[model samples]
Target: MEKEFNGRDLKLGQIQDGNSDYTRYHITYKSGDLTISGIMNIPKGIPPEDGWPVLFLNHGHIDTSVYTNGRGLRREQDYLARQGFAVLHSDYRNHTQSDKDPNTETDVRLGYVEDVINAVMAVKNSDISSLSKERFGMLGHSMGGGISQAVMVVRPDLVDAIVLYAPVSSDVVDSYNRWTLRNSSNAEKIRSAHGSPEENPEFWKNMSPRTFFDRVKTPIIIFHGTADESCDIEWSRETRELLLAAGKRVELVEYPGQYHEFGATFDDFMKRSSDFFKNNLK
Candidate 1:
């Protein structure tokens, strides 16, 4: 998993105009044999000597069929870019214009992790004069946060810092109970093929990021709202506890009355997020 994913052959499509602080463009980067589509935002000013420090933005779970390029993290894309960071928001495989992944449903979507790792490599290998080459920061929301967790464990040095906003559990067993088998009809298909979490602890552990938290070198800060109904705040609490037990650098900030998506507290949240990346990423 670490030897490859050197992102290559980046292609930027037509420019998107509207924002005043940064320039937006549609883009594609190689992820294995697949061509992943995404959106990028470059701040509309001169980059620092080492180029703009980057942020790999990962979005929450949206129905893939209806998802568009940079759909879920538009606010972050713009907000982070305007604050002088190059933002790469991947749509992941089989979403938006990315190539289809035939094994997505059966597999645990580890391919999404590949896409992000490759995205980091793409920026590192690109000829863009304004992209950073040092350790980058990543921000993931909800299911995307789960993917970022895998990214951290799979390649600890790939990203130096991570911000998880109302993330899902790092444990696959918890995830399976909360999402996969909760109200979905795919339980039989999953159990028939790979057995249930209770029936197959090893399989679930192999699929979990918590199993590899001891390998994580990235500094992480998590933000969760008390009233987030879609994803319980307890998830982040448990995740932080596990990370702390592993002796990892981590912090968890709980908003007293916020929800799944930050509303009244978004500005303050972004401010802290901005500071976290600035203080951690090199």
Candidate 2:
């Protein structure tokens, strides 16, 4: 069962000050038996003659569109809207107000990527007047970043470019292994049901962006905090190195002493993110 929030009156200004050209709406995209819910932020005040760029924004693990909405990232979305960009930030199946599919919800990670693809397709095919699919990009944070990478490998045509914040590195198995060891109880339970890194090596390998770097041709910009404790800075560094080695277009930005969710700050994270979109989405 899915509970929906239209957020019809959800003020973008609640997150930050920006032009009033953006309006937020909730959408449901079909994925097999599942109905995935998402938030679409469309830039207003533009004539139908002008075409705007589109960006698919994905939230991190254990997070939702509500968090992004409250944390002022929606303001960043509004800022992009003011700049003539349409942003769709979505909640993966089983998270937040999204519906859960019994078949995929049990494996949350894969469901996240599927929901991302669904969101992108929904935005691309939506009847909404404010969105344009020809100019498309993807922006994601943490686990969402990892999903963005996976999406690039499978559906690069849906996106022209990507911007990742504190993205999880390509070595997903190792990362999960370390995480499992540190947080034994919960990790073990998930592993027991979903299979451990060792048991499901193929799944981990397929999901890893590092392993599929050769398949990625789209330009990518990745940001990470060197002091990040959750996902670690080494992951970003390794990804950067792999992408560079593959002769792919990649830009890596590292912030010193910043931890996970460094972008929660209104000025620092929101401003930098908006700037990145402005520069690359052009």
Candidate 3:
């Protein structure tokens, strides 16, 4: 938690074909020693007085072997950019062409949280005149939701608002046991490195965002489907309950019969998310 992140040498390159409302660019920034890749979408119109509000887009877990640059969160990026927010979608280290982090899996994805924090710092340290310094929001889906939670607790000053779409448990151990333990040998790998959650309660608690909810500054809104098979709706319910108990501003919007990927309800959630960023980021 005390580590310093120098999000320096941010370079925006290669303007790509974009929708009518925005322009897209490939971007790279320094997260520690590794060069991280991402995409930035800037709205086509003029900027506000304080400049355009920034949204850091955190995507769900993808197999790193198959992941490419700017591979995830395409719809959210387009909708948010079209809504006049400057969106930055980072492909966390060890994914795509970005440099690898050897400790990523064994350390339980904390490196991802660090990369995200650095992405925010990169914006702050950049010479991008169109981006806002104050009004920074975050949108995370599934595994991305978990990363955003850690980011909130670790760097409370960075985000103005947060939208968690079908997030995993704030407790990383739950996610580990649910996915890792049931599916593969990774459970033993992680346990051998950090010890099991039961065996090393202090270590696990220190890493889980649930342990540090009091440090969160952003107003959190979680959207979950009642029938989400990938990520149980109960996870979001527990998150909202914990946040409320911590005296933080939080709300959970449940969608009945909606799945994890939000098929019919995608536009609805996007509209609600636009409203949230508008009210908070403005």
Candidate 4:
């Protein structure tokens, strides 16, 4: 069973300096009685008239054994903050200090999606002086990109725009098969516990963001590498094609021969991302 999350009654504390221009805070919120912890970056200066526009950042999966808070995409967070935007990145359930959600294979990443949505609600109703309630955006990388797509379908009004980095496939069955083939041992364990995607096609279908693209109205931009070995570049291309076919506002940026993280083109990617958010949110 899934836990119901209330976006109201959010609590934030344990503030620390992210940098000279931004402060990071410890976020404590409810995803149906499970306590989740995350980091929020706020600009030090006075907020704009309505309030400072904020971005809710979603990070891809990391092995929880060594995962720590703010582990994913700190560079991007810092850049976004320095560029005068407030950023919030959730550790997600079971990662870092956040409490764990029940594990399931069929649902796969939906619980993480719920955690991100809960973070969105928490930020929307939060009392942070520097965060604007009306203007909001999202950025996700890899698995996080997949989460972002799912979130857009579930809560289209939560964010004004979204940017994806080397996202995984929206087809849950494909993702499962690919993952299983890559790590057979872990795959067997997972399958034994939750059943294989082949045994549960309907569940996989229900869990896919592609199934709900019609509900997604948020404008989107995606960046992927042609030489990526982790997640096939085709996943992103297929996603972009699907969104276009659905008549949704979307764009895809491809970097030739770049790896999954865009190590060589991080600067260019950040510049385009910053510009996209600035144009859409500000």
Top candidate (TM-score): 3
Per-residue lDDT of candidate 2, residues 87-181 (tens digit): 77776676555675554533536767766776666655556555664667888888778888888776666677888888877777765766546
- Cα lDDT tens digits, model 4, 111-138, are 7888788887777777766678888899
Which one wins on lDDT?
Answer: 3
TM-score of structure candidate 2:
0.80
Q: Between candidates 3 and 4, which one is better according to lDDT?
A: 3
Each model's lDDT: 0.88, 0.67, 0.90, 0.83
Alpha-carbon shift of residue 18 in model 3 (angstroms): 1.6
TM-score of each: 0.95, 0.80, 0.97, 0.91
Off by over 4 Å in 3: 182-184
**Which tens-of-lDDT digit does each residue in 1-282 have in candidate 3?**
878878877788899768789999999999999999999999988899778999999999899988887888898999999898999999999998688998888888788888899999999898888888778999999999999999899988788999999999998878977887875677888889888888998898898899999999899999999999999899899999999999999989999999998989999999999999899875
Error of 2 at 203 (Å): 3.8
RMSD list, candidates in order: 1.5, 5.8, 1.2, 2.3
- Candidates 2 and 3 compared by TM-score, better number: 3
On lDDT, the stronger of 1 and 2 is 1
State the lDDT of candidate 1 residue by residue for 1-282, as single tens digits.
445777887777878754778889899999989999998988877789989998999999899878978899788888888888889899999998999998775677778988999999988888887888885999999999999999999999988899999998898777778778764556767777778988987888988899989999999999999999888899899999999999999999999899999999999889999989988876
Q: lDDT of model 1 at residue 141? A: 97
Model 2, position 217, has a per-residue lDDT of 67
